[model samples]
Target: MATAKLKMSEVRGDVAVGVAQGGATVHALKLEGGKNVPLCPTRPKNGLRHMGLAHEQKPDLELCMKCSAIVPTGPVTVTKEQVSIPGLDRTVIRKVVRPVNDTDTTTEEEEAPVMAENTTTADPRDAQVEEIRASIERLPSLLEADNAEGAEELNGEIETAIAGLGGKGVAALRKTLRAERDKALAAGEEAKAAKTPSAEIVNLETKELDDNGKALIQKGIDKVKELAVNKFQGGHAIAEIVLDIRLGITTKNGYPDISADTDLGKKVGGALIFDDILAGLPEEGEDEASDAIRAEIGSIKKSARNAMQDVKVRYVRSLDNSPEEAKKFGYALEAHPDKKPSEAVFTFHGIQSLTRAEQAKQARELKAAEKEKTRLAIEAGELSEEEAEALSSDGEKSEKEKRTETSNKLKKTALKLISDVKGIEDEEEKDEALEALTVLFADLRKALTAK
Candidate 1:
């Protein structure tokens, strides 16, 4: 005894059904006794039907058997239709629903129509192209501002973006950049070509000399050479010597004495005047001969000074008590009246061995004299006995002091032996002398330690 279910579309006009006032279509029966509700054709799920209602409208309520007293039971028909927009390239799907008589209970779906291909949706490469275009647009302003570094950096970004686009875009901008680069290169070349040649600058301190200055300098050089050969006998440097002689001949005003009537004065005046001229010439234009002469003089003076420093001088006892030793030693003698003839001093220059031997002998003599003086002072009560004992050595001396005294005596004896060996040309006699000196040194060492 179930009631027969029917769809709104399947219902015939002969069926007895309540229709709402003002010709509204009946959607469902109010079984409990209420007004019949009007049907919404757009809401198929509400089991409502209207033939003339717009298909764009949406369903207002959810349809269920519990809310409606009489539910429409029929097959649901779904139709997919393509709706094209006016400006857009692609079409949208419009889903239409229709009520149909249910001969079977299975659900059904309909395929939508194919749409025409268009570019309405966004392309994946569009963003990249926009970024490249923006970079390219910014490049011109950077170039105009003379921001080469900024422009280059921006250009690289633009190029990278364009390269990502497979080099299809930015042709005009690339041509512009190339034209600008060529213009800059041409302008640089033009500027370089138009530049004027500059004159060679001369230093104030070393400017070139004139012809008259050259002749004067050459004459001064000849005079210096002549002076070195005649006066210094080419044995000593001439620069300092010539400088002194020139200064002597010149007056306080730094000019030569040209008014002198004597021949020697005339020669000095000529030489000094030429020297003044040479000194006044610029250093840059100085003749090579003058430079060579100056260098030679400097070398000779340096060598002479070094030789003097290396010369060794020794003081020895005078054998004859005469001043002849002073002349032979190349030093003046110093008078010592209190000393004996054996103790009278003589000097030997440029003799290292003789100098060391004499120095050792003098040191030993001084020590002995001091000891004797200390003993005498104690006897006269001028010095305390304890002080005299301190001055004199004990029976056992310090090992260091004894060794030093022994070494000095040995050095003196060895120096004497070397001197004698040098005098003897025979090799065998020299060897014999050396052996004898060695034996004497051994004996001396023993005697010193015994004391």
Candidate 2:
């Protein structure tokens, strides 16, 4: 039983959604006992779509099997005592403090004449929920008024309110509000109708969607095209030679799945790519090419970082015409056409791969430096070899010690064999000897691991 982060519905009574904790999303019901049960043993064929407990809740929330089930038939004690759910590594259950109901059933005459000043008050969360509902209702009008700042302020307020008093209703409202904002911004962009002739036309099937939705998709496509054009630098451009941009827009949720036809290589046609420019000194040492490459790489990293920043700001632009959000989600471009155009397809990972490689290199360098320091300390007599070994070990018999011993033994054997082979003047005989040693070692390893 997985521990679920469940919330009571605000839009309807006796309804809730259980948000399970994992890599993939799931549909489950959180019982009064706080145990989560999957809605169906088998996942829906169409996949688990949104089952938000709000107004306009999708019709796909029905149970898979119409089998009879047992539910609690009597009043059960509900306590805040924490209970562990087995199999789940971690559990996070929000303690919801609901206002206690006043059950004063005594007649007027039987009631206490004097009370010690009744201090019972309504829960502050209730008031906050009301405020959130009010703000949500006002969002459409705010967008209509073209008050971007005011709308942003209201959105911030709603986010704060929901953060304090979390429920499926509030989340649904926020989603709706975000959709409205996207639609409004898209409408404005469409009205301007600034068509780009040079821009790559995105071939997407958006006929099934409404006008506003289509506009939103178009706006996103245009943004991607614009970003590709801007990020592209002819000389220092890398792998992806963007021949065509295709989008598969989900009408259920307007997020576009972006991909492009690309050509992967160090150099596309005769043009110098990113790697070629990086290795500049061998051919064009300290020249304008080197300077341009440095500048271009710097600009790329800066823009990539800025795009990441926009994600923290919730991927919504404060201004309608901003391109940072689009750039964050779009792929890099190439100015020069590839010799073999559309040879391969690409997704967004060029910048990420570079960053990850740099990080790995830094880690390796740091580890080597630490090892060097230990060796120097041993040589200087500041630390004894025994003490160094002890410091590096976990216990009396460490895995590290075992690995080092095995590695040293192998190296010694290889060196002795190489020395013996070096004395042989005939290259063919020496190669044959080395090959025999490799076969012997490989057979020995197989025998050792045969169990």
Candidate 3:
């Protein structure tokens, strides 16, 4: 046999549950939309007659046992209550334990509630960057220990990191590695002074040519000097003279058996051209005269080269991107200390242009503004004097170093944007998005760099 007892259900919103009408017992289930459900057709009236209200009308409702058979099986609670003991003294008021069904009506929302969102989340990329920087920081110690294997591994890692960061202008980072490599390798290039051939060798070589050969040599030297003055105003720091003479073998097939086509090249800026003064010189021939002319031309080219070496003029470039032709005329090939590495100006004899003056003025203004800002910070207690001075010292790095740093940062950001844009399958949309990003970056740079 199974137990039978009344099971009341909590009511909610226009639906009465676990209350059987015209019957004492009720099941713990509700009817959908006030309609009869086959599981429990005798549901309570809507918001009208439930267990508590029915008990107030009729005290005998507590003993109702109508819908208990279809009630869902679950755990029952036990509690002590004052009741008469069975088979003991009549009307004895003794405490007895009795099983109780769960009658407390509480919604699920009242038991547990949702929690608020947590705001703190750590970004892992920042940690990766820090780890890479820490590795780089260990390089000096590794080099000091002469740990070649460790240094090599670290070098590879740093190179990979630099590539990921848009590698450019990072050649200086490998100086330590190069120094270690240099320990086991000897330099191949001889000193420039030690490599010079003796003048006697030149004389001996020239002796093989006739008077015509000597004249050709003098002609070539004169031509080099003339071009030097015309191009570089008496500067011959990096000019070279080139000559060529060709000869053909006997024409057994009777096609004029060509030989000795004399030609010369005007060498400038590492390029040889026949369009200059050395276009056509010695007449073509196959006999002894042609051989003699060829020897003469060779002598002339050699003599011209020697003269260029002796032309002693020192010139320096105002910037890295200065004209190459300027170097040929004894100008300094090094960039000026005061000029930016990216500037394209070329200067000789310490010449200063109007643009340079403006640049100097702006540089001074920037320095003054930086100084004032530091001073204000210190006075306002935003920074200590020591910290301000330390920052000023840091700003004292060379302009080229600063420019290279800025360029590398820009390149890194641009590369990331390019990589993202490349993922777009539509070519036209990619191009458009890339252009918009470029313009946006330009605007952002302008805004950030503004005074």
Ranking by lDDT: 1, 2, 3
C-alpha RMSD (angstroms) for model 3: 31.0
Models, CA RMSD each: 42.5, 33.0, 31.0
The better candidate by TM-score, 2 or 3, is 2
- Winning model by TM-score: 2
lDDT of 3 by residue, 317-359 (tens): 2324455433332223344546443222234233333343455
Q: State the TM-score for model 1.
A: 0.15
Q: Candidate 2: lDDT over CA atoms?
A: 0.41
Error of 1 at 321 (Å): 11
Q: Candidate 1 vs candidate 3: which has greater lDDT?
A: 1
8: Cα error in model 2, Å: 25
Positional deviation of residue 373's Cα in model 3 after best superposition, in angstroms:
52
In model 3, which range of ten residues has the least summed lDDT? 112-121
Question: What TM-score does structure 3 among the candidates reach?
Answer: 0.15
Off by over 4 Å in 3: 1-130, 133-451
Error of model 2, residue 263, in angstroms: 86
